[model samples]
Target chain A: MTTMVLSGNEACVEGALRSGVRFFAGYPITPSSEIAEEMARRLPALGGKFIQMEDELASMAAVVGASLAGLKAMTATSGPGFSLMQENIGMAVMLEAPCVVVNVQRAGPSTGWATWPAQGDVMAARWGTHGDHPAIVLTPWSVKESFELTVRAVNLAERLRTPVILLSDAIIGRLREKVDLPPSVPVVDRPRPAMAPDHYRPYAGGPDGVPPMADFGTGYRWYATTTTHNERGYPVGVDAAAAEGLLKRLHSKIHDHQDEVVLTEGRWLEDSEVVVVAYGSVARSALAAVKQARSRGLKAGLLRLVTLWPFPSQLISQVAQRIRGLLVAEMNMGQMVEKVREASCGASEVWSVARFNGQYLMPEQILDKLEEVRRAWR
Target chain B: MALMRNRDMVERYFRRGALPTTWCPGCGLGTATGAMVRAIDQLGLDADKVVIVTGIGCSGQVYTLLNFDGFHGTHGRALAAATGIKFANPELTVIAPMGDGDCAAIGGNHFIQAARRNMDITAIIMANQAYGMTGGQYSPLTPMGSFTSTSPYGHIEPPFDMCALAIAAGATYVARGTVYHTQELVRLIARGIAHRGFSVIEVLAPCPVQFGRRNAMATPVDMFRQLQRATVSVREAELHPEAIGGRAVRGVLREVEGPEFTAEYEALIRRAKGDTHG
Candidate 1:
């Protein structure tokens, strides 16, 4: 173990290496470029490989390809690059390849503020790729959390046989912090098929929905495609029943395990009238506002979402039943707030505090929203 | 023909169940695939050690038909995928089988860069000069004044000379063969697979259903004979460059060893780790 000061992007690369990532294919994008640059510098020392792909599309395609070849692979990007990755991300979803994609988010619909922070990709990270497939997105509130979540993202991707998105922002990505990073963390490599090579069903798993994967050149000759396919991994073409079964399994594999996938942290929730829901760097501001409200003798609490996808809806719903009002604060105009409102199910009054002018939400702004909600109740 | 079908190479390499491929009858994809199989057989390469990557198109179906570790990726990204597969495990012989449009049009940048890196991967490009799977759309490889569905008034764009493009991009091995010359194609593909750096073998195969029916060459034999007549030897092409239009120069255009990307990457890792002996 060693203590060192590191930025979120640097921690991400270190955590990827500790998670046994041996292959990285990515295009350089601002705020996220540090992840690629660090990977290029450090991966070689560990005998891992780094490649600067031509674009995000190829970077994602290459990551999927490397994962299928039995390597833990990753790619980092932001904004426009993330948009370019949607098609191949769908491919990774359909093929059930275990890989991580890091989006060090910057402001934009199209290259908006390159060096600034934005939480605009919260919803986009889940539904960015066009399909009904499940997405796993993790938000790191601090630099240390960035390292932990990077490792968690890789493990979850390997365990579930799917792509995991480490949804970060420019603030956390560039923020430097001192913390203890272990020399090595526990790595969860995808299990290889133990079945006979000739008779193996590539998409058939054990009790879990994830199937054991075989690397290329491992004597397990099989096929993989992005099309809806059966257990055999060949294209199912127009087999409606097969497609239905495949899609159902893919969804259930994640949804059925939501207890394990969804992560959240609650502060002052035991007894509170108003609760603020926040994620990413905005969570820091949210905690401060909750403390300020408490100092002013107002019963306020905070609910921080560490995992953005699979929604952690059950926890939100449960908390909604206890609290009187909820305020959602984020860097975007309103993305995850809609999810917060839907999950609350009218049990509590839900409102959003948004900031999209290329700035993060401040604690004072969140405190103002909390005060407004309190006044409305009077 | 019966004896050849009974040979161990065919029985061992082809997955009989996956046979009767998705390709139409008289489609040159079948011949192109056969040549690739023959090439692997000639090299005595282990099937388990071969990873075939293909993109969306009629040519992309080759990976599915072969009994090897295969990846049928998204449209036009086969080479990009192959680059990762090769770099991840240099022990495996990575092969990307792509269509004219798959490699030259949508994936053009990846194609040029992959060659530029001199990565150790074999790329077999089936240059049918048109998008065969999508009802004969004109592609970047579609020759000037060629009529197709998208170019009903004849194409205005000039086609890419694939071998020349690869050669200029620093491919260590560059060659061209027509589907009509299956034996020669087999030899060229074998050489490509054996090359230590990036190798591209462009097979001028025919897309009878999409391309032939649109042009005057309606029959499979017409397309085959056209290839036979238009192909000139590399020596003949150099001696009489003027007569090379509307034709392909066959045989190995370039074969030279250089710093292969994966090997260089390994050496870099050794140096970074202070493994001076490596």
Candidate 2:
């Protein structure tokens, strides 16, 4: 292992290259521009392709197309660009193309703050695309986890045959930290079709619910459509049964395997009265606040979410059942608090600690919320 | 003998049990699709090595009927997707078929930039004047004062000359043909696919149900006759300028050699790899 001080965005580039991503297509956007810049500089030297597309829509489309052509591809953008990418991201889901979309989030409802951090896109990453589809979203709080989770994101996307979103905030994206980089990390590639070209059905999944993909020029000759398609990869216009089966399989491919897809980290949860639920950059503040509260004779702990989507509901429920109150802290205006409340099933009082004014949720602020929740419990 | 040869070509290139296309009875997109398939067959291209990327429209359904691997993507993004396909595997032939709205209006930026970069792909713009799949809506290619579902007051916007836009955007090969000129359209498409850089072949396909019924031409034959009378070949126009009054010019508008995107990128990769002789 070698020690280097790198920002979250730089670490993500290293992780993507380590994960065997050979194609990078993107448009420049703030906070996420470093990822694209690093890719532009690093990819060509490694004999990979890097393209600066006309817009985010083209970037997303190109990434999906490259993935289908048998290359691990990615694109990075901010909120405005991520919103533009939603339609093609939906296309990626429908086509079952494996690619990674890194959204280094900045404040928005339309460019609210260009250079500041906010976790407002948590909900959009899950439901920005139209239709009922499965989503795998990974969040990282530290620079080290940024590299680790990006590798995980690429692996999960390839294994499940879906577009994975690495949702990072501005603070985490620009924050610098010294991390030990491994010489090599495990890489997973999309399963190639083992069946003969004549017998292969492109969308026919095996026991794992993931169909082996064939490259375009490899003689499989199977077509892929964004429209609802049958196992033969032909459009199933208004065929309710085929549509239902395809949609359900798309969902269950990731949902049924949540045990491997969902990941989280817990602190002081063995004997704690108040547990703070947090993710992304706000989790750093929550962890610090939990430690401070424990030192001050308060029974407090932190439940840091590494996988934001598939919501970690089971783990949240288990933690909620054992705690007196759950403090959900985030850099947004009460997005995941609702999910925490639902998962807790009224077993614990859920309090939302939000900060959406283009600033980090400081550890001191989270400590105040923890104190408030503790007093209310009494 | 001609009918037998055409039947053999269809059997060889078309997908089994995939025809009876979804196009309307009198749609000109069928003719355009036939011309494209014939061009591919004439060029002796391998079916397994070709990938057809299409956008959302009545014209986009052309890929579904072909035996080659295909991607039926969302509206107005076929060229962008095709660009990726070509870049990822330069050995594969990427053909993108898009409608007027899909090519010139919503996907205009991608079209221009693809040409500007001189990406190696063939783009067949089926310029049916209006959006036929969404009923009859005015598009950027819809002629001025043409009535449609969206433009009941007669479209005030001037239609874009797609061939000129492509030439100005630095396409290495550009051509235009009407669906009425089936043999010429096939030849143009074949040449476009053979070009080393970006090629745009705009086919003036008639949307009889949507574009013709609103205009004076109510029948498919009337629309075909109108196209035959309104367009002149580039050689004919040059020979007799008086014969080309306000008629649209057909045939190759631009063909020139320039650096192709993928080849240049490969050289850049070699240079980045510290190979001095690349």
Candidate 3:
């Protein structure tokens, strides 16, 4: 509909606005502050609410609260802020609030490098919170993909009644690119309660397993807690079976609908002997290396992951049989290589090309790894 | 029979079978809860139009006993949650119940910022002087030279004057009441709820089993008597500064006019939407 040049963070904010996000709460941090700054500037024009909370913890808590009150809410942060957000992230999961959390990741165990790129938070996004709950994480490799995937993240969050993380890194987040964005896109809203005021079950769903939500002022006044709850949204502590059922349901709602939740893109995997598994910013390099290797008669392929969590294990398992070897390239010290290795199940050799010195993985570096894997296979 | 049925006062507001409350007997939390219910009852607020958010603590469990749009959530984040609720639905009356430790220590940033923003919400800080739910840990509100489980020796830190902190942080309505004076607490709470700006009513409740048993006040009656003896009226406190060292100030400490957050936000929305008349 329209062509424009925008950075990944700018497109992220634009996409969120287009996706019906009206409430945004955030604390400023590097590489992700543009999302908050953009939200503050644009939200007022649209009559939406934007708040700069005192810290990341409150920012997350506010998002959960706003989502409960029936506005699609979001928050953004980098590594340290994302780490501080873990406590309330668990709360959002337990309460099943629909909100988006964007973590434009930077290199860090603790504030390692503020302005550099790294996929160090891949596992943290999945298991950072203190409990066993399902997570939906979407990773994007380009400015346009960041915009599009952010919109997708919001939709999935509302549809599933859970928190969704849009995992971007400094490389994609700061890099500017020209792209065509749609004039309008389809916006999906959470299901509304079908039952009467007196009979509404806020946590009960139909065949889809996602319950209709009610806002605070609605007549369906019910209690929500971090503790295990029944269908009526009341805490059902000490009842072992009820707790088990609730936990199982929370995981199954996302797992059972894997077709909708898991998304990936495969390039030249049909007849290639070497496949490179990559995501986020590093995927671009992997693509470059794949093309170079193909030109050199090495038969290399690229499998770029769009949805980082739910692992896309089925896809890897399916393609593992045909490929002789796989190279997993990322910005961290081999976080996702383990997943590829496990999914391959030894059908193919899994090699890692990880760089964590606050730098992006180069195409040549990826090509070098692919050459090594090719040599080993021969 | 003369009439159909009569229910107990607490039962009139509490959720059915959600009671047999877990609060310790001789704990002032029950009395404080009763005052809160009476305040809401006196204000005649609709249950469907109210939301009670609680942080993790003994105070956090209050939501389960009452019928309303309630959220019992993470430690020290009740105000943050309440802030969101009020922003989303400005017409709804949002209230948060938090403990001294939960509000002043863990959630201190939110408390200060919420007041600074003058957000339209009422926060009831239960000043029991110790962490009751966690087995009598030393809290930010524990009096100087007082003993608790964590402070096996006398606590060296001075307690926070919650009302003063709230007033300094720009709360429009700030007050202090004790469980010993239930009627006053109900009145203060109701008035705070009626205010359209940030309001705080700090209730000096007794934690007999956790705080009192560790300190010199071993019995609930002793705690109540101490509350009565150590508290001075607002007028008396101003007049007799010398004798007010060990005494707590009671009554409204601050009530002033200011722009309410929700009302201002509504006007912003109207302006943004190009509605000139608003």
Candidate with best TM-score: 2
lDDT of 1 by residue, B1-278 (tens): 11124256557887767777888777898888888888887788988999999998888888777789989989989988898888899999998999989999999999999999999999999989888888899988888898999999989999899999999999999999989987788889999999999999999988878888888889999989888998998888999999998677899999998999999998999999999999
Best by DockQ: 2
List of clashing residue pairs for candidate 2: none
Instruction: For all candidates, state DockQ relative to the true structure.
Output: 0.84, 0.85, 0.75
The model with the greatest lDDT is 2
- Alpha-carbon lDDT of model 1: 0.90
TM-score, each model? 0.98, 0.99, 0.97
Tens-digit lDDT track of model 2 for A19-99: 999999999999899999999899999889999999999999999999999999999999999999999999999999999
Per-residue alpha-carbon lDDT of candidate 3 for residues A263-295, written as tens digits (9 for 90 to 100): 999999997998999999999999999999999
> What does the lDDT come to for candidate 2?
0.92
Q: What are the per-residue Cα lDDT tens digits for candidate 2 across B1-278?
A: 02225678679988898778889878989888888888888888988899999999897788788888999988999999998889989999999999999999989999999999998899999999999999989999989998999999999999899999999999999999999998999999999999999999999988989999999989999999999998999999999999899899999989999999999999999999999999
Q: Which stretches of candidate 3 lie over 4 Å from their true place?
A: B1-8, B238-245, B271-278
Q: Quote fnat for model 1.
A: 0.86
Model 1, A301: alpha-carbon shift in Å? 1.0
Candidate 3 falls in which docking quality class?
A: medium
Whole-model lDDT per candidate:
0.90, 0.92, 0.90
